[model samples]
Target: MSSQPVQGLPILPGSTFRDPTKTAFHRSQTLSYKNGFAFKQTPTVGIGGTRLYVNQLSQAELDELSNKRPTLTYGQPKQAPPSDFIPAHVAFDKKVLKFDGYFQEDVPISTEEHFRIRQVGIYYYLEDDSMSVMEPIVENSGMPQGKLIKRQRLPKNDCGDHYHWKDLNRGINITIYGKTFRIVDCDAFTETFLQSQGIELNPPEKMIFDPYTELRNMPLRMYVTPSDFDQLKQFLTFDRMVSLGFVALVLHRILSQRTFPSCVLEISDQEVLEWFTSKDFAVGKSTTLLGRSFFIYNCDEFTRQYYQDKFGITDFQPVNIKKQPPEEIKQIIPPYNGYGFLEDSLQNCFSLIPQPPRKNIIKMLENDRKVLRYAVRLESPRPEDEKRQFILSYCLATDMISIYEPPVRNSGIIGGKFLGKTRVPKPGSSTENPVYYEPSDFTVGAMVEVFSHRFIIVDVDEYVMNYIEHNLESFPASVVESMRNHFAPRKAAKEALKK
Candidate 1:
């Protein structure tokens, strides 16, 4: 049969598969193979051989494939709410308070209620009150306001016995004098005062008293109520009088009623005495006594002298004078000879006491000294079947040998080996009842018998042995021979075989 040329077939440049029967180039513009493989012809460039670039499906093919496949529909796309549609619950306030200054609210007071000024703030009490009518105010102006928007009452009577200040619950309000005010918070001074009085309350979450905004010249207006105004005014007047050196003689009279015959009486102006005695106002005796009189015993040297010169009081003694020991006669007593007279005198005069040497520095110095250590396997004559491993240390200075054994129980050895030293008993003693020996007891190369086992002072540490080897000429021939002959494994093995 004559081979017929396929017409209308698009040429695939650089394609290796040219057999028309096995692989057909279709009009749909895709290459299909009878061997069940579909390949798309792509652009090619010739190097040593044809290089074909595989192409992804074209846009038309992708659209056709997408249409043929069933289109999956998830739920409809989320739609944003209309711009003007606000929820019914949303509320806005037009009249926002812009002032940074503290504002006072009028709190209503009743006969049944009494307000206690606590460190945490003012608290109110009622027989069956469960909640306090106070609003939570957040103070930060720079940040967005907190979510708590409305005024809420705190649970009350939870602590029990509101009459006792210590028992009153925290975060509650008390109506004082027909006005509404929340005890916003308290300060450290107030908290300390309550703690001193044995009244415990929850500490205020925040400090309400701003030092920069606190009015120092005027009394705290927040604490002053209509009922307390007259009393405060009188108290202020009394305070001013005391500041002006006016004595409250009524206090002296009260003290005189309780005074003994030995008490000293200091007389004051008759007019001043009469004025205080006539007034019906509450006179706080402690405040009056502390504020009015200057105790001679508490006076400093300068103050005492001034009082003595001005007031003719010569019997005053300091309240807090330190009692000193009687002076010693240095000529009669022998001086301390422990550290030399001159050194002691210098130390006492200049505070030049010698300090103990640093342990770390001493340890570092000790570390610099070469320590000769060796590991050896020992065999006991009585325990023929058993073998014990020991670490031996040789002291070069004293020519002594120290031996150590592995601990009964491993205490976490790193790197799969117990390299650290374990305490070894003295030659005649057991491990449980250990008795260590002095370094001068053993000489180098000596076969010391320990635990009834012969332990040849076999080896020195590698570094120490190497150092000795390099400086062998400096050492005695006998000493060198002993070091070299110590712990010969071949000789030991031969001796063991003969035994």
Candidate 2:
């Protein structure tokens, strides 16, 4: 047969050979070792007769190569979960945003001495979205491809008085980052997902539980300014990736660095006298327990015992009594009833700075100095016109800005509950300021320290009314008059216009 080049054979391109025998192998190796006939060195042949001839790769050979493949170590970075992981509380409040309004309640007292009987509750949407104040650790286990949606479950308890919206559809279904969660079924998942997220399922044994804790689980009254309202809203939407555990963190920031200490003892001359004379002495025995820190002398048996157990009796005793104080009791100060205030302070103070590994005390102080609002004063009465200064400053600074109308003034103290149709004591009046009562032990709402100025609005009604009436009253008289006019004109027509 006439010589004809194998038609389908891949032409052996010219190549320099280390050895002509090896040249065929080199060509095959470059082609990942395709089976082919080997060539031998021959200096006389054109370019030393080295050539490649293809052959079928057998199934058995392919199987052996596949089995011998080397293991690969993949090195890829991890990714985090989708961004819209919102808490249930936040979603519900946002869903019911439009239903907020002013509401008042009437409370009847069966006392021989009676006063203004109106119990006021101002209703409005305050953002209650549960959100993580702390940012989550971005890790690779979760895929970030999808969106996030938050669901809020309604309270199972009789939260009617505290909740503004009590409709059947009280639950919230919200979309965030392309994921949707049903809140009614959410708390159940807290045990699982939260655990996976590094949260321990069991509360620590040392997590002091008081028999009276149930008593203290009262509804917290909150008053928010327009500025604060805006802040809370921003925290809910943009910061939805945060978890519920972080709320404590946010609260700690507000509580820790507020401009005012948690408690203030404005002692009157009589209070100082009562302290020395009373069997169970107190410097300001009758002073309202309004703020968080409460004082108990070492004399009380129950309190002393409690402290002894918590901090050990020797540590609880005078400092000189111990050789080396137990570190636990050295800082074993009882958890203040107002501990929430301190936690809130720390939470809020930290919020102003950026994320984790909290700033050192010096750095925090430096930042506070730059942002002076968080610097609440902690002080004792000074010799220079202390009482007079305190009263005047309190009058000017306290959030209670309502002009005292005589009947309301006569019946109750500034922050006291109002009894219907009764006279209130005048400021600086001789008569003891009528004993004010709380329907519930007061709760701190939100505290803000701006510059060196600090104001905390605990209950919404008085603070909101005071701020709005004073700050926003400059609208045109014509506008105000027209609004009133529209409402007063034939009821049906006005109603129709509203509809």
Candidate 3:
């Protein structure tokens, strides 16, 4: 047959077996004026195709779509009163009666399979009186499972009557397709429905597990050990005032945490009042609370007094706190760079201005003109320089050192002001930190080096000797002892002359 449309008829060149049109085209499908769909869907048939698409319409569905009613043969259909014609099944659509059941399967091949009990869930729809059975999918069960019975009306036997929701009850046997399922328990709706029907169901039964299943679900043996944790150092370092583990019971969420403390207490007020005030909480008594243990070795004096007054309990030993780590000392002030005194360096660190360090005005006023003087002889290669005398004066107020030479008779050397007043650092001192000479360095028999010339101190003035004796505490012990030794014989000679 050629695939082409008939000429001027608006009919298609296809016909189904039910509605055929003289082997050419169906005339009923060609009626464009009948308000039918203008564009007809073409069938998915190609050249030399063997299979055809079948329309999945039943005779009842076709009759309903065509608005045709079945002819009544059994005495005229009786019409009930409109008030009593209420349909219940339609109103309870999708309501299903669920049950827990299991069936025993016989395995003849293996010893363990001689009896296998497989648990299943059964559901019966109330509206349609249809039922379905489902076997729970087990991991690596090595058996095909799930949907053992699809939802459909099942026959009571080989008869026309099907299984109804009324036939299902807990702790009963439901045989579908020759396999019997023992219903153990049912859901709430099923129980309520059964009771409404005046049928008392058997008490819910537990599922029977075979030996293999029970062995598989058995819990394994285990050994647990307490964990070792250290936080005393951290506790002492961060919050030193936390007296004991009791502090953590309040602040550290001790009730919620799962760690093993010495003794743990819940945060509830009732439990606190019941457990905390007992004699078990007294000093020297050990008590275990929640999951931890605590020893009340000691309490504060106030707490001890309260316990003594209230409970007549005494004898509290002190708790050892040596485990608390020492407080770490941080470097608060930076090191001195040796450019100036420590106070001058500290003042500079605070401000950007390069100001002079604050002076001691009282000390400057008291010792402005006070100077320590010593007679010195310069060591030179020329023999005449050995007799030359030099005076080295150290000013106490400004820490300035000056040198002067006395005019000698018949000496070729002119000696007015030998060295101007300036701070003289010791030989090999850095220029950045010129360590000026101080009064402690001006002593009789001491050596002074200036401008590459070495001079030996020959003597000091009477005022200098008196000052050194008065301020022996300021000098080194060796220098003080030597000065004391030199004055001892003089003091003895003065006493002998008086005698």
Q: Which candidate is the best by lDDT?
A: 3
Candidate 3 per-residue lDDT, tens place, 461-498, comes to 66776777787777777766665665677779999999
TM-score of 2: 0.12
**What would you estimate as the lDDT of candidate 3?**
0.69
Report lDDT per candidate.
Answer: 0.42, 0.30, 0.69
RMSD of each: 27.7, 39.3, 33.3
Candidate 1: stretches off by over 4 Å:
1-118, 121-371, 377-386, 393-466, 469-479, 487-499
Residue runs of model 2 more than 4 Å from their true location after superposition: 1-11, 14-77, 81-96, 100-126, 129-499
Flag regions of model 3 displaced more than 4 Å.
1-358, 486-499
Which pairs in model 3 have colliding backbones? Answer: 262-293
Model 1 agreement with the true structure over 177-204: per-residue lDDT tens digits: 3433334344454455457778766644
Local lDDT at 74 for model 3 = 48
